[model samples]
Target: MAKAYANPDVLVSTEWVAEHHQDPSVRIVESDEDVLLYQQGHVPGAVMIDWHTDLQDQVVRDYIDKERFARLCSSKGIANDTTVVFYGDKNNWWACYAFWVFKLYGHAECRIMNGGRKRWEADGREWSREPEPQYPATSYVAAEPDPSLRAFQAEVLKHQNKGKPLVDVRSPGEYTGELLHMPDYPQEGALRGGHIPGAISIPWSRSVNDDGTFKSARDLEKIYVREAGLKRRSPIVAYCRIGERSSHTWFVLHYLLGFPKVKNYDGSWTEWGNTVGVPIEKGPGGTASAEASS
Candidate 1:
């Protein structure tokens, strides 16, 4: 078995949460895309924070800027001592992403829900209909950047044809150039309707079950190790339309499997898929984007 963290350090079950709702050390954060879903109903004592708005820096580079992210957590009353239990309606992927952002900022006290809110509700967990905004005053300190935790375009290009893994979480159609959104003005350096030269395909949806909860670590290990030939120790870069989906995977690798060097290409396909000239490989047949050399 892999080295799993203690209960307080990792994903806690809905039942466990119920038992600790009033515990001052624990805090539940609802990181849903649709605020209405959380506002309408959420686990008791849970507070809402739209993953898109409340969590990320969401500008160019598509990462959580350290200073801003730290302040956001502090603003939400999350402190170094706060043991976060993050859950969301979207299979908990975004929740995991949010949890990852905090970890990137050097906060190790956070945990994401195994399945997410849907499973919690399915299991008949007690919930609330009221919303309470949290504003806490605490200082969060961010340490050195975890360079191994991310990748940039230059690094990705170097590994393109060498079979170095850069997992694309986009749909097959998008990866194959069948439905890619052509940018308004062709990007200065972009790839056409193809994926990175040596990247593999693992649609983001594969990580989550139909009900939006993450599969167990044991099952995930099988999918990753047997199917992808990747273990917790593998050097992999996960990317998607943006960095959000990949961030979800980053959390899985770092937190669930305790992988140390899994990097997220934050710019992702949104940046690569748009570059003017780059080697691309699509299903059936492939072509290097004319833009690669331009």
Candidate 2:
């Protein structure tokens, strides 16, 4: 297949992952929603990074601070220059979310393993129970968090006021307020249903294929550009019930489609839906249909 995005290096295929995974310069990180999935079976030499425990602050609703981030990387044998390749289950939902958090700490050498665990297992790739040997911990210092790639509720409100693009990457049921969570899952349900007023529903699943590999750039153009009416220059923010699923879309638009400015509103519906007096829209007629933006 032809190269899709302007900067296509953000993604690495399974074949490429298999070849380079054991390289000293490469570190394979598996971040999954199901915390125990990695222990069941995983890519050889891959280290599991639990999305909840490893990535988030223990007592707060925020991510781990930079100091903790540096420590986590050190424990994982990741240095400032390590090329970290992320892959996992649920179509890389938590994997991409982990990647987004990595970007927050200014890790530049990160890439997502294309097709994630679904494709990896389907291909009958090598799996292992043996742990990859960890390199000696290096003194790693995380860079200052990049505010540009993340969105706060204030910025999301501003985007709404300005009529800018806000992509709701949740399922249709959640988007329409008919379901509080993804179809069958009740554990992740939010207090309120419905989407942010003026936000467009473009489920993150549309970004990938049945085999869990992403579609060609041409097809992506049709989905995000033609169907959702997104533009390259426009400021776009994606969100889900939580931030995880939206991070997948953020990767697609920013790294895959090469949009210049894209942010993931990490607070997402969990924050918005519960906040008092936050405007929300429900039902088919609630959201304004997207049209191609200039």
TM-scores for the candidates: 0.83, 0.95
Q: In terms of lDDT, which candidate is strongest?
A: 2
Candidate with best TM-score:
2
lDDT on C-alpha atoms for all candidate structures? 0.69, 0.87
* Model 2 / residue 211 / CA error / Å: 1.2
Clash count, one per candidate: 14, 0
Off by over 4 Å in 1: 1-9, 58-64, 181-191, 284-294
Query: Model 1 over residues 199-280: C-alpha lDDT tens digits?
Result: 6666677777776666666666665555655645556788876677788877766666676777888777778877777767
Model 2 Cα lDDT, one tens digit per residue, 45-142? 88888889999998999999999999999999999999999999888988899999999999989999989999998888988877555777978899
Total backbone collisions, model 1: 14
